[model samples]
Target: MQILIAGASGFLGRRLVSHLRDAGHDVTPLVRRPPRPGEVRWDPTSGVLDATVVAAADAVINLAGAGVADKRWTSQYKQVLLDSRVDTTRTIARAIAAAPDKPRVLLNSSAVGYYGDTGDHAVDETAPAGEGFLADVCKVWEAATGPAEDAGTRVVLLRTGFPLDKDGGLLKPLYLQFRLFAGGPMGSGRQYLPWISLPDWLDAVGFLLERDVSGPVNLTGPEPVTNAEFSAALGRVLHRPSLLPVPGFALRAAVGEFGGEALASQRVLPGVLVREGFTFAHQTVEEALQQAVSSITQ
Candidate 1:
């Protein structure tokens, strides 16, 4: 299949591009700069995208969004987060709508933060949108794909969780902290942390690309563990002691409003993926951490 992906330079995106290419799919990346070979130039900020480019792809995936945890939640950066996602999604969706021959599907990125702090309650794709800044951002972010959906495209809102790998995502820094003996749960350590192994995350994306599914799909593991459980799993995998814990107030002081959210509980479940018969390579956090740690050592 011919796939065109925005945000192809990002950590997950870079891996996805390679994964798809290795699987014999022709993947073209949408770049901000001038077009290179096998690349399409698009500027979401300027709303510049060729409809022909959109029409030619068999599928389109838009993972373009500002990192929610990259900066403190100041009003300015908050707007930046909102605009970065909404604008890019709107541009891609509009392009797809304008195309004479539309792509079969659009897998747009979202986050499990859509459910806000779920406490211990589990949530699937059918859950209502929750409150808080990250939740609000995810709401608008997913809604930005309206144009393409209105144009009859099969839109899949990827409500992703923490994709754990040794190189990037949530595990990298945590790995370092563990090695230094500073790693432990944040806040009360009771908040649930929804996670998926990196390999599983990549494979799930491929599964969604071909599956006859639409709407919000939780790209998370089958069994979600609490932050404390996550810390224990990582510690066990690394032969480190998981004793020190970061207090909630200290987290809030360090990263502003996002700090509270860092410890938010989201026991998200992959309802669609499971019902569709997608299998996970790592069913538990410990197994996931083992793979991630092994990758780092090698």
Candidate 2:
């Protein structure tokens, strides 16, 4: 398979490129810089991409976006978050639509924030859009894939959860905090945290590439855990004590607008993945945390 991916330099994108290439798939990355061998150049901010490039690929996976937690969500940075995702997705969708021969599928990125703060309730793909800044961003982000989907291209909206790995995602800072014996749950710790192991996330993307499925797919683990449970599991895995609990106000003070979201409850389930018979190697939060920790030491 020939796969063209936007945001190929990101944490997940970099790993995905290696994973696909290891599986013997031809992967071409979309870059903002000058083109290198086996790479495509496109300015997504300006919606500049050759339709021929879209036509040449068997599949296109877009993971492009400004990092939500990268900086304080000022009104300016908030717009950056929206534009980065919506503009990039719209660019690819338009290119795919304009192509004489469209790619077989478009796997665009989204987030579980589409469900807002679900509290104790569990949600699947069928859930309606939620309210809030992140929710609004996700709605527009997913809708940006309209052109490709309307053009009869199979479009998959990857409503990803928190991916657990030693190198990145929400785990990095927490790992450091635990190492310094200052780690604990955030806020009430009762809020559900939808998380998936890095390996399962990679495998699920590969699975969807071949499966005859479309629309919103939640890339979360089968069993969602509360923030407290997750913190405890991480502490156990690292042989550290999980006694401290950060209040919501402190979190908000620490990370600004992203803190509210950091404590947001989302009991998201991988309904599509499970219904389609996708298997997870790590079913529990503890298991996932152990694997993540061991991966670092090994």
Candidate 3:
């Protein structure tokens, strides 16, 4: 398959490129800088893009977006988050629609944040959008794909969860604290965390590319754990003690609005993936953490 991926330099996108290439697929990355040999260059914010290349792709995955947790949620950063996601998606979708030969599948990225604080409740794709700033952003984010969807492209919204990796993910920060002997649960540790290992995330996206699936798919693991449980599992896997705890107030003070999400309880289940018979390479938190540590340290 000839796959075109936007945001290919990001944490997940780079991995996807390698995964597909190793499997004998043609993967062309749409970068933001000057064209580098095989890569396609375009800045979505500036309305620059290669429409013909977009149209010719067998499959297109737009993972382009600013990281929600990258910075403190000042008002300025909030707008940046919105523009990065909505504008980038709009640019890619428009190009796909304008293409003479449209891609068969469009895999757009979304997040479990769409569900907002679900508390201990199990959320599936059938669940309605939850409340909060991130939820609002997600609603607009997925809605930006209407152009491609209306153009008869098979649009799949990957409503993914926290992707576990040792060197470059949500785990790295916690790992640092752990190394300093301050590793423990954040907030009350009761909030449910929906997560998936990097391997499963990549494989699941590839599976969706081949299957006849569309609409929102929850790309999370079958098992969801509370913050405390996740902390324990991660500690066990890293062979470190999990004893310290970050208070809810401290978390909120540290990251502002995003801290609300960090402490928010969302137990999203991979309902679509399961019903579609997609096999997961990793299931439990401990399993994912162990795999991540071994793979990265190697």
| lDDT tens digits, residue span 147-257, model 1 | 999999999999999999888889988999999999999999999999999899999999999999999999999999999999999999998999999999999999999
Stretches > 4 Å off in candidate 2: none
* lDDT-sorted candidate list, best first: 2, 1, 3
TM-score of predicted model 1? 0.99
| Poorest 10 consecutive residues by lDDT, candidate 1 | 289-298
- Summing lDDT over every window of 10 consecutive residues in candidate 3, give the lowest-scoring window: 289-298
Per-model TM-score, in order, reads 0.99, 0.99, 0.97
Is candidate 1 or 3 superior in TM-score?
A: 1
Candidate 3 Cα errors over 4 Å, as ranges: 296-298
Q: What is the lDDT of residue 69 in candidate 3?
A: 86
Model 3 earns a TM-score of: 0.97
Q: Where does candidate 1 clash, by residue pair?
A: none
TM-score of the candidate numbered 2? 0.99
Judged by whole-model lDDT over C-alpha atoms, candidate 1 comes out at 0.94
**Best of the candidates, lDDT:** 2
Q: lDDT (CA) for every model shown?
A: 0.94, 0.95, 0.90
Once all C-alphas are superposed, what RMSD does model 3 give against the true structure?
A: 1.1
